[model samples]
Target: MTAFDAAAEFDRQVRTLLDRGHPEAAGLTAAEFGALLAPLRETVTERGGAAVAVAPEEGRVPFVLVVTREVVPVERAVALTTLAGRTKPGVVDRHFADGDLIRFTPTKEVELPDAHAYVLFDVERGEEFCGAVPEDAMAAIADRGRTPLTIEEGIALVTQYPAALAKNKCFSLGGSRCGDRRVPAIWISQNAPKLGWCWAGNPHSWLGMASAAGRAAAGT
Candidate 1:
């Protein structure tokens, strides 16, 4: 949990995306995707701190490479994510099988860079809000001057640190909304990852609202 090689970590993330066929989904080759991300290396190196993914209360900040839905559809990205040697692809809940039907865009408060991809820093698991309603947790997050994690950001966290999506500690993506009460969330299922949604007004003892200090688009 000490400071890590920022550049190296960024490289590893790029490889993860490539390995998971992100570029292919986006109609680009691995090399092309690499080229697309090359400009962000310097920003990552300059902004990255201790290589940790848990909330800052744990004493270390975290950063992740985020490819927006524009680059690779959320459903595709989820299916590409894996748990170590597992061959099972992540699943999207039946409710959202038609990904196109859900326009789960980032909330107004979550200002992502204009680019297709970016980096999120100071990530938090939001365990402190476990058992709190998503709507309430969001207000608390805003009160503290923090931004909630969007679906893309949440996926990026687990895509980089699978262990972060643990049992009884999964988080809600309050930063993304579909004009209804459903709040997206990522959690472990059958040893693989799953993208699902829960009611915004409801509270779960195991689900907390994940958050970030801020984000920066790649190449900016």
Candidate 2:
């Protein structure tokens, strides 16, 4: 799609969020959500098609509207998520919810702006890295100058584009790691999207690491 088309697509995503009542889920009204995105919309329109242009050549996710934990906790975000055409809401793995022991903080390389709502650009599903170890995939992604997706970003991804989390095409959220070997991921479970984790050193043919070119406040 052309740059203008990409921008239009971005707008459509924003509308999708509103249509899904995500703003209400986050305790914000539609007007409030619109107000929050006003500046980002200006920036995106001004750039024309720069957002899509910078994406990876394949499986590029042009943009995603992310509502951070500050606005809605991860657990709540997971509950709000749903697979396409399915009424069953997405879920957080019981393991992840166990005592809240897994603190999936963003890796040092993935810097996010200090805003409850922002946009991630040029994301990729990392299908080429399928069956590669999460740790190794992270290194390869960095070598390519891309940053991995955090749990929040991963949720935002499938939240906006549920089809991206297909049966074997699921992705790992390498950007968020606990202080251990666990690498968080999102996949299909019982026909619904699920937030789970895998060992950092392990590899899964169905799961590839997810990454993004960068993140920025929408208004920026």
Location of the lowest summed lDDT over 10 successive residues in candidate 1: 51-60
Give TM per candidate: 0.89, 0.90
lDDT of 1 by residue, 122-151 (tens): 788898888999999999999988899988
Best by TM-score: 2
Model 1 misplaced stretches (Cα beyond 4 Å):
48-61, 97-101
lDDT of each: 0.80, 0.80
Show the lowest summed lDDT stretch of 10 residues, model 2. 49-58
TM-score of model 2 vs. true structure:
0.90
lDDT of 2 by residue, 5-103 (tens): 656766787787787777787789998877776667655555545565554343567777787887767877787778777878898888766655337
Evaluate model 1: give its TM-score: 0.89
